[model samples]
Target: MATETLTYGNGTSLQASNLPLNGSSAGKPVDIAMDARRVFEVLKNGGLAIVPADIGYGLVAIDPKALERAFVTKQRQPHKRHAMIGSYALHKELHVLPEREANMVELLTRDIDLPLGVIAPLKMNHPIVQKLGSETLARSSVDGTLAMLVNGGKFQDELVRLTSEAGLPLMGSSANLTGKGTKSLVEDIEPEILAVADIVLDYGKRKFSEPRPSSTMIDFRNVEVLRFGACYDVIQDVLVRFYGITLPEDPGRGANFSGHLREAAKR
Candidate 1:
């Protein structure tokens, strides 16, 4: 497929917006066919797209080179790990859990409003992670843990399905540069990042505010709160309200995977 090449810096960005602002479909949004076609072309060709995410737009792609390009565009450090949004099917395949907790973990992370990330140990080799990013990939290989995001929404599910069809799990990171404030609005993206992306899917701004963060991340093995970014309060309530389970403030008490918890430069 010949991809429509878009470049930036002359004056304006070559946006893959819903519709050309002044054309025949000026006021009409880009139909699903055009949208999906662009998405397929970007991922298939190692191109990058800034697509809508649960919290904000995300730098999405299945190609390793595209992922690496995102790392550069975000100005993110090499030590940061990129989280992936994938189907329950892929989640079940990649994350190896004890029989007693597998189902429970799935219940906690999937089919929810707040995006949740599960850090599960790899049951088998996922060479695809190498393409996702190096900083986190190197760390995860040593730690033996991978963070997987499971989104149940139809839109996100479609992307996951597409990734599966392509034979790779979809991986992405919030489109924000490190240390800068997190941004959910399309207009908030830095020019440098926009310039590098092959396509920018700009529908509009997001609804959530500071209180709302990206997916709340937890370790899959023990259900420890890795970071209370998004839906931290609601998830905590959901655990106890429905399942009669309460997370330990210090889930590290057992510390089953100290190697994973500890920094590994010297390991």
Candidate 2:
């Protein structure tokens, strides 16, 4: 099968061409109606695809059953589940979080421009979220003008509908291989990863000051910050506003941690 290639220039345009009609188109953008249909066919046939994340882009396997393949390709640990990227409207729909979690989502979506990540509970059982843990699912919005669906297009609702119907939460992560900095264009991705991918919807190079990593991981299960990244301050600020609780300066460990939060929740 012929490989599909896309060129992401400096935030100008994203163009996809030369994609095999029956191959995976997971992480790539599906702008045209035919492209979207063709990609679905390939995915139905067990093909793998890649997609762009808000910061960079990501690999998405066609077979929801084969989510592990995408993670392994990125050399990411199986336990670290990928975040789901969807539209603001869809986020409002699929979200079946508790009042506290729902309140947080409202706050984040209200301030949409700022990159926000929410560690909320999942309503249905999904392989991706289940693999990580049954407690919470992390979600964020993919913002890019060129790549609408992945980048917040009207089709974003379609993507979310498909995923929700399939009972699968997309495992969204940066396009570059694990531990590597976020890549700006298709050419910047590693060849090994690109080789297995079915299609690449290049949006050209992005013009961001620096590669903004995904938001920090705050596990409500543990009520702890797993990793510090882009949305640390914003998350803390939101939590305080909604819960009337102040997070510690250092989220590492001590008397104040998830344990304390859990205890307070019970009270």
Candidate 3:
């Protein structure tokens, strides 16, 4: 099928008509309509698109079937999970997490400059979340400017509407091969990934700093840090302040780390 294209503008008519939200398609090749709502729809329909972030642009696909194809194209392992991004509205549609976890989501949504990820449980069970483990879900949000690149202005609302309409949670992650540089445009993506993609949204070329490895993942299930990444220190501080729990000083095994945190708490 021919890819659909939509030019986002400042007009509210598009939002009222839900035109951008309706354009997203799954299982069929559809060019990104260029609106955040539309992109969300495309993702919900199992289509693939590219998103530009403060750090850089990455690939996004909401459909599990499409994601499987994306992983193969990027040579990404199935065990490694993807992240999610959208407006606050989109975040609310996700699983109803604990207040503390909800607070984290609010904090990230409030700060447009911080490029962080939220690990929570999916609102509902699905093969994707099941594969990642039931204890957590991934959530993220790009700055408004980045949202505008895809959808003119109502980026957040559009995202919420599309996801709600499709009843699918999106998998957000950087668009690059594992341990390789992230591609900025649809054309730059490795051909392997492109071949399996149902839709390829091109936002043109962009310069990016050395890709920051994936965000550190924390399993709120036990309120423990799982993998340490760029946001480790920040997450540590948050957990400590909010839950009165301290993390380990040493950056080693769980036994050692937990022991360290316990020792510090005692003091």
TM-score of each: 0.74, 0.61, 0.54
Error of 3 at 183 (Å): 4.7
lDDT of 2 at 142: 21
Writing each residue's lDDT as its tens digit, candidate 1 over 121-198 gives: 875465555444565466344377888776534446676777776666577777677655446776788877777777
Better of 1 and 3 by TM-score: 1
Q: What root-mean-square deviation over C-alphas does model 1 reach?
A: 6.9
| Candidates 2 and 3 compared by TM-score, better number | 2
lDDT of 2 by residue, 137-220 (tens): 332222211011222333334545565556545444556577675565556778767776766655444432132444444544
* Tens digits of per-residue lDDT for model 3, 1-267: 334433222222211232342234442222333456556656766687655443445566766666666666677655555555554555454445688766665664454223344445544444433433323232122111011111112333355456645555555566777655555444555655544444444434443232233344444444555444334566567657766778644354333332223333555
* Predicted structure with the largest TM-score when compared to the true one: 1
Misplaced by over 4 Å in model 1 are: 1-34, 109-113, 126-136, 139-142, 207-210, 243-267
* lDDT computed for candidate 3: 0.47
lDDT of 1: 0.61
